[model samples]
Target chain A: MNCQDLQRLVHAYLDYELDLMTSLDLEAHLNECSACRARHAEMRALRDLEARQLRFHAAPAPLKARIARNMRAACGNDDARRWRAWRAATAVSVLALAALLAWVVLPRTLPGPHQVVAQSQEKMVYHIANSEDVATALRNVANLLEISPDARIVVVANNQGVDFLLRGARDRDGTPYEPAVSRLKVRGVDFRVCNNTLARRRIDSSQVIPEAKLVPSGIAEISRLQTREGYAYMKL
Target chain B: MMPHVDAAYNLAWWLVRNRADAEDAVQEAFLRAYKFFGSFRGDDGRAWLLAIVRNACYALRGQAPGAGVNEEFDEQVHLPGMVAEGSNGPFCRNPEDIAIQHADRELVNRAIEELPVVFREVLVMREIEELSYKEIARIVDVPLGTVMSRLARGRRLLHEAIVARMKKESPK
Candidate 1:
C-alpha cells in the first residue's frame, strides 16, 4: 500500500478494523514512511487522551431506581392480570374454592393504606404546570398534611406554573399565591421552580417568592423525588 | 437489559449534551424498549439499548426550540497535513508539555463538546465506549464506511482543537 492509501486506512488499522492481510500491508508501509508513522502516533495519542480524559457519565442511582419502578409498574400489573385471567379460565371447582378462600383471607391479613402510612414517613411530590395546577396541589397538600402532619411534600413548578411563585403574582381573583405558599411553607411543604423556565421567560431570581426554591429543572426534581427520595408523584 | 442503563445513559448524555434532556431520553428509550421488547431478537443488548437511546436523543432534539445545528463534515476543510506539520503538532512538543495538555480535563472536554453531534457521537462510541466499527455502524444506522470516516475525522478535529486550545492557553 502507498502513503495516500495508508492515510485512508490508518484509523481502521489503529482500530483493528483492517483484515490481517491488509493490516500487514499497512504495517509494511508504516515501516518505510516516517510521515505516516508520525500520523499514526498522533492518532494513537489522541485515542489514549480520549480514553483517559473523556468523562463517562454513569446513570445516577435515582435513574436506575426510576427505571426499575417504571418497569415493575408496567409489567407487574399486566402479568398479574394475565395470570389471574388464565387461572380463572383454567380453574376447576376445587381450585375456584381455594382461590375464593384466599381472596377472602388476603385482604383481612394485608396492611391497609392507613397502617402502611403509619409505619413509614409519607413522602409525596406534586408536579405543577400552570396556575390551576398550583391551586389543586395546594389543596391536596393541605389535606394530606391534615391527615399525616409529618408527611414530606414538595411542589415542583415549571413553565407557566412558576408564574404563581413570582412576587406580585396573583390568582384569577387577584388573590396573591404568597399567603397560601407561606402557609404551606410553615407546615414544612417545600416549593421548587424550574430555573430553565425562569431563564427562558427572562424572569429574575429576585422575582420569585421567598418560600420557593429554584431547581435546575422541574422534571428532573420530580424524577429525583420519586426515585431517590421514595416520594409518591401527583400531577395536577 | 437492566444492566445496560449506564451505557444507555452515557450515550444519551453525549448525544443530547445535557443532563435533563439525557435523563428524559433515557427514560423514553427504556419505556419504548419495554413496550417493543418482543421485537428485540438481538443477542447484544447494549447495542440495542444504545440505538434506542440515540433515537430518543434525536427525538428530544427535534422537540427542543432552536437546538444547535450539527456541522457537516468537509474533508477539504480538514486537510491532513495542516495539523500534523504545524508547530502545535501532537509530537512536535516536548514530553512534559504534551502531558500537561492531556491532563487538562476541561480543555479536552470542551474540544469534544464543540464538535458537531455527528462526529462527536462516532468518537464517543469508539474511543469512550470501545465499540467495534461494525457495531457503531449498526447503532448509528450508517454504512460501515461512514463510521470509519466519521471516526477518523472526529479524532482529527478533536486533536486539532486540543492543540489549538493548548497554544492559545500557553503563556508567551
Candidate 2:
C-alpha cells in the first residue's frame, strides 16, 4: 500500500506478473496515489519503447542453409553425419588439438589433403546450372584467371550443370567442356560435383570425369564456403 | 514441433555477438538437439532448443571474439552487483521526448552487446523473442524471480547506455 511496497511490485504489475490479490492491492494503491499511477504508466511506456526499439533480426540465408544442412545430416545417419561434421570442422581449425581430434575421429581411409579444401581469402566459388551458361562460366573462369591468376577457384556443379563434369559431356554447341575443365585443373581450378544430384539421377561417381571431385551437399557446401570460409560466390 | 532455426540462431547471435560464432553455436546446438530429440519429452521445443544453444555458447566462452568475454557469469556473485531499477517514481520526462536519435538497430545491438552475458541473454529472449517468463526461466535454468530481476536490470542498463551514446554523439 505504501510507496516502497509499490516500487517492489510496480514492474510486476506493469508486466502482469502479479497474483490476483497482489494485483488488486497494486491497483488500489495506484487509484489512491497519483505518483504510483504515473510510475505504472511510465513503466509500461518504457517497456513498450524498448520493445519497439529493440527488434528481432532473422538469421541470414547462408547461416540458415548451413544449419538446415547440418540438421538434415543429423536426421539422416548418425555415424555418417558425425564423420562429415568432423570433415567440416577440419576445414575450420588447423590447431594441433583440432588435427589430433580429426586424426582420432577419422577412418584410415580419410580423404587426402589434396581433396581437402581450406578456402583461403583469395579463393572463389563459381556455380553453373544451365547448359547454355557452360561457355559463359568457362569464359568467366578464363577471365578470372587472367585478372587474378593467383586466385584459387572452385567450380561447383549441381542439378543439370553436373553434366559438364561428366566424362565426354559436351557444351550446348556440342564441343566438349572436358578440355576446358582439364586445362583449368592443370592451372589449379577445382571442379566439385554434387553427390546428391548424381545419386538421385542414378549417375555413378566413376562415370564422372576423373578430375572432378564429389561433394556430399552442393548447396550446403556453397553456402558454408561463402558464409564461413569467405569464398566469393558467382552464379552463371 | 521443432523450434525454428531462426529462434535458435538469434539467441546464439545475441550471446556470441557475431555471425560466424553464432552460426557455429547454432549448428552445434541443432546437431546436439537432433541427436537427443528422442530424449526430449516436453512440448516446449523452443526452450529446449535454446538450452542447447546456450550450452553451445558457453562452450565458446573463451573463443568468441566479442565484448565481455572475460566476464563469465556467476549468479551468486553477480546477483548482488546488479543495480536494482526501481520503477516507483513520478513520471516527469515524456518517454516520447527521450529518444536517442542514434539508437538504430545497430546501436541497440551494440548496447545489448555491452550488457553482461547473463542479463543480455534473458533480455533478448524476453523482449525481442517475446518468450514467456516460464519459458525464459526454463531456458536459462533459473527461477522466475531471477528472470524478472535480470530483465528489469537489463532494460535499465540498456536505456542508460542508449542515452549516454546519444549524449556522446551530440554537439559539444
Candidate 3:
C-alpha cells in the first residue's frame, strides 16, 4: 500500500472494518512508512481520545419507566380488546349461565323478600389486569361500600394489575399506591395478588405490599369465589 | 427491544445534543418500532430499532424550526484546512503536536458536539458505541463507503476543532 492508499484505508483499519488482506496490507504500509505511521497514530489517538472522553448517556430511570408504562399500555389495550371480543362472542352462553344460576340457586339460598331487603349482604369479586384497572377497582369498591356498608369486595389482581400492589408501585402522579391500598385494607376490602403471576414474572412475594394476600392463582380464586362463595364477578 | 434502549438513547443523545430531546426521540422511536413491529422480520433488533431512532431524531430536528438547519454537511465549508483525501502530506499533525493526550473530557466533548449531525452520529456510533461499520450503515441508512467517509471526516473535524480550541486557550 502507498501513502495515498494508507491514508484512505487507515481509518477503516483502525476501526477494524477492513478485510484481512487489506488490513495486512495497511499494517505493512504503516510499518514501512514513518509519515503514514505518524498519521495513523494521530488517528488512533483521536479514536482512543473519543472512546475515553465521549459520554454515553444512558436512558434515565424515569425514561425507562415511561417507556415501560407506554409499552404495557399499548399491549394491555390490545389484550383488552381481544378479551372484549372473546367475551362478546361468548356473551350469550355467559348470559344463559347467569340466568340458570339465578333461577335455580337464588330462591333456595336466600331469605324471603322482606327479610332479604334487610339482611342480605352484597358479595362482589373484581378482576384487575392493569394499573388503570386498579384505579377503577379502587373507585368502584369505594362507591360500593358507600352504598352498602356491609358489602364484601375482593380484588383479584393478575398480570400487570399486580404491579400496583407491589412495593414502591406509584400512580402517574407519583403518589405511592401503598397508602391507598392500606386505607382500603382497613375498610374491609380484600386485595388478593396472583402468585402465579409473581412466579411467571419472576417476582418474589416479598416484593408485594403487606396489604395484599397472595392467592395460588388469580383466575382460580375468582372461580372459587364465583362458584362456591356466590360472589358476583366484575372485570374493571 | 428493551435491551437496546441504552444504545438507542446514546445515539439519540449525541444526534440531538440534549438529554430531554434524546429521551423524546427514543420514546418516539420505540413507539414507531412497536407500531411497525409486524413489518420487522426479526433480524438484529438493535440495528432495526436504532434506524428508527435515527429517523426519529431527524424528524424531531425537522419539526423544530432552525434546530438542524445546518445538518447538510458541506465538504468545503466543514473541512476547511482539512488535508485533501489521499494526499501525500499528513492528514493531521502528530497527536503530541495537538496535546491530544491532555485533551480533557469537556474539550473532547465540545469538539465532538460541534461536528455536524451526520458526522456526529457516525462518530458516536463507531467510537463511543463501538458499533460495526455495517451496523452503523444500516442505522444511518448509508452505504459502507459513506459510513467510512463520514467517520474519517468526523474524526478529523473533531481533532482539528480540539487543536484550534487548545491553541486559542494557550497562553502564547
Candidate topping lDDT:
3
> Rank by lDDT, descending?
3, 1, 2
Model 1 agreement with the true structure over A1-236: per-residue lDDT tens digits: 87657767888987768988999998898898776777777777777788679987888889989997886687577554443333232222222332343344344553332233323356667788987677656766775564346778888999988999999988753668898899999999999999999999999999999999999999999878755665656666
Model 1 chain B: ten consecutive residues of lowest lDDT? B64-73
Over the stretch A119-197, how does candidate 2's per-residue lDDT look in tens digits? 2224568887766677767765764464345667888888988888898898533668788889999989999999999
Candidate 2 falls in which docking quality class?
incorrect
lDDT of 1 by residue, B1-172 (tens): 3445777788888887888999999999988877666566554556777888888898887843113423353444544335454454333333324433354888998889998788898888886667789889998887798788778777777877887778788755
Question: Which lDDT tens digits does candidate 2 get at residues B1-172?
Answer: 1225667778888888888888888888877876776666664555677889888998877533223422235222332213344543323233434555336666766787898887799888876666678888888777787677677656656666776666676635
The TM-scores, one per candidate, come to: 0.56, 0.51, 0.57
Candidate 3 lDDT tens digits, A101-190:
433555566432222222336667888988777765786676456435577889999999999999999975376999888877898999
Off by over 4 Å in 1: A79-236, B63-76, B79-103
Better of 2 and 3 by lDDT: 3
Query: How well does candidate 1 match the true structure, expressed as C-alpha RMSD?
Result: 21.0
Please give me the DockQ of candidate 2 compared with the native complex: 0.16
In order, the first chain's TM-score in every candidate is 0.51, 0.48, 0.52
Residue A158, candidate 3: Cα error in Å is: 46
What stretches of model 3 exceed 4 Å from their correct place?
A79-236, B63-78, B81-96
